[model samples]
Target: MAYCPKCKGEMPQTAAQCPHCQFDFPVESPTGEGARTGFAYSPLADFALLVSMIAATIGSVSTAIGSIVAVFHGHFFEGLFIGPIAFFLQLGMLVTFLRVTKLGEEKQ
Candidate 1:
């Protein structure tokens, strides 16, 4: 089974037009309103992007400031490891979220 690009309804693989929504899968009627195969950006991705941005900002600022303060206070060992580790973990999480979002949108 294949899914309609517009409505995401399952249809026969050989179907050219979606029976559920009557959207033509490949060809349009020259009016340009019925081209159903075009990719649409997911709203969920927008939310994810906002969340990731916030996470990154919080992580970076906290980590950097924490490390700097620790170093200035003469706690070199703790600052050298904990701060950068936290920042990098947040960065990795942001990248992974972005990649998953893009892949999900493309598959739609």
Candidate 2:
């Protein structure tokens, strides 16, 4: 599936025009700048994606290490607490990233 670049409306991948907004798809060039294979360019979206990815990586690593260390050091109860905390942390980051993408689509 593909989305209309102008209105972000869902459509068929082979669609030449958006059925909802009647927006025409641009011709495919060698560079594919207007290709239907991906999301349209948005500076804010790019930055948010990069930052969120980095944060998620670091946060996950630390959370894992911290949880393991706590359990091994006789802090089993603390390890239990850390599990849910880390889960929420990751969930929040995911939500934030999704929100940014939605905003980017809306502003495009």
Candidate 3:
């Protein structure tokens, strides 16, 4: 599904014009490029999200690696006990972030 920018009405993706507003879908703008699609997009927000996801992924992997190393190095208490816990917590947070962000945008 797609949305009409004019009326913010829900419409079929193949719609040529908004049924509610009768706004014709632009085939070419004065700039000679086709109309842009979708709404509520922000480049800065996207970039920030990209950076955050990358960092979170790195952190999660490092925790797992650290845990394995600690156990092999005879630090079984910290490696087995603390490493898995920390890694799982970070992973949960990352998943939560992704879900919330996606839901928030859709509800907007």
Candidate 4:
């Protein structure tokens, strides 16, 4: 279930060299320090996502309140602006979270 680094081919678990490309494989240490494992969540990315989500939530709430107040004040155009901007910001944050999560998964 291992892949040969040189030939990019499937090699047997006990393979020392890639049969297809005659490339020598790096022997893994008994401590398992040489082989690359699965992907992990990066703390910085997670922190950024958390912050974005919080900001998006706050922005959305504020936008709703602002739009409602503006509507009551007869400022239709102002309400329109605030509502769309808030929605766009929330959508952007959701998309960002999804993209980063997908990237982390793919790296595994």
Model number with the top TM-score: 3
Kindly indicate the candidate among 1 and 4 with the higher TM-score.
Answer: 4
Score every model by TM-score.
Answer: 0.47, 0.42, 0.51, 0.48
Candidate 2: segments with Cα more than 4 A from true spot? 1-49, 102-107
Provide the overall lDDT of each model, using Cα atoms, as 2-decimal numbers. Answer: 0.76, 0.74, 0.79, 0.75
For model 2, the run of ten residues with the poorest summed lDDT: 31-40
Q: Which candidate is the best by lDDT?
A: 3
Residues 5-65 of candidate 4: C-alpha lDDT, one tens digit per residue = 8768988889888888989856767435334343333576568777887787787777888
**Which ranges of candidate 1 are over 4 A from the true structure?**
1-53
Off-target runs (Cα >4 Å) in candidate 3 are 1-51
For candidate 4, the 10 contiguous residues with the lowest summed lDDT are 31-40
lDDT of 2 by residue, 23-74 (tens): 9867566444344234435666577687886787678677777878888998
Judged by TM-score relative to the true structure, which candidate is superior, 3 or 4?
A: 3
lDDT of 3: 0.79
RMSD of each: 10.1, 11.3, 10.3, 8.6
Task: Show pairs that collide, candidate 3.
Answer: none
lDDT of 1 by residue, 1-108 (tens): 988989999998888899999998575354344443333335665676778877887887888889889999999876898878987888787777678767656755
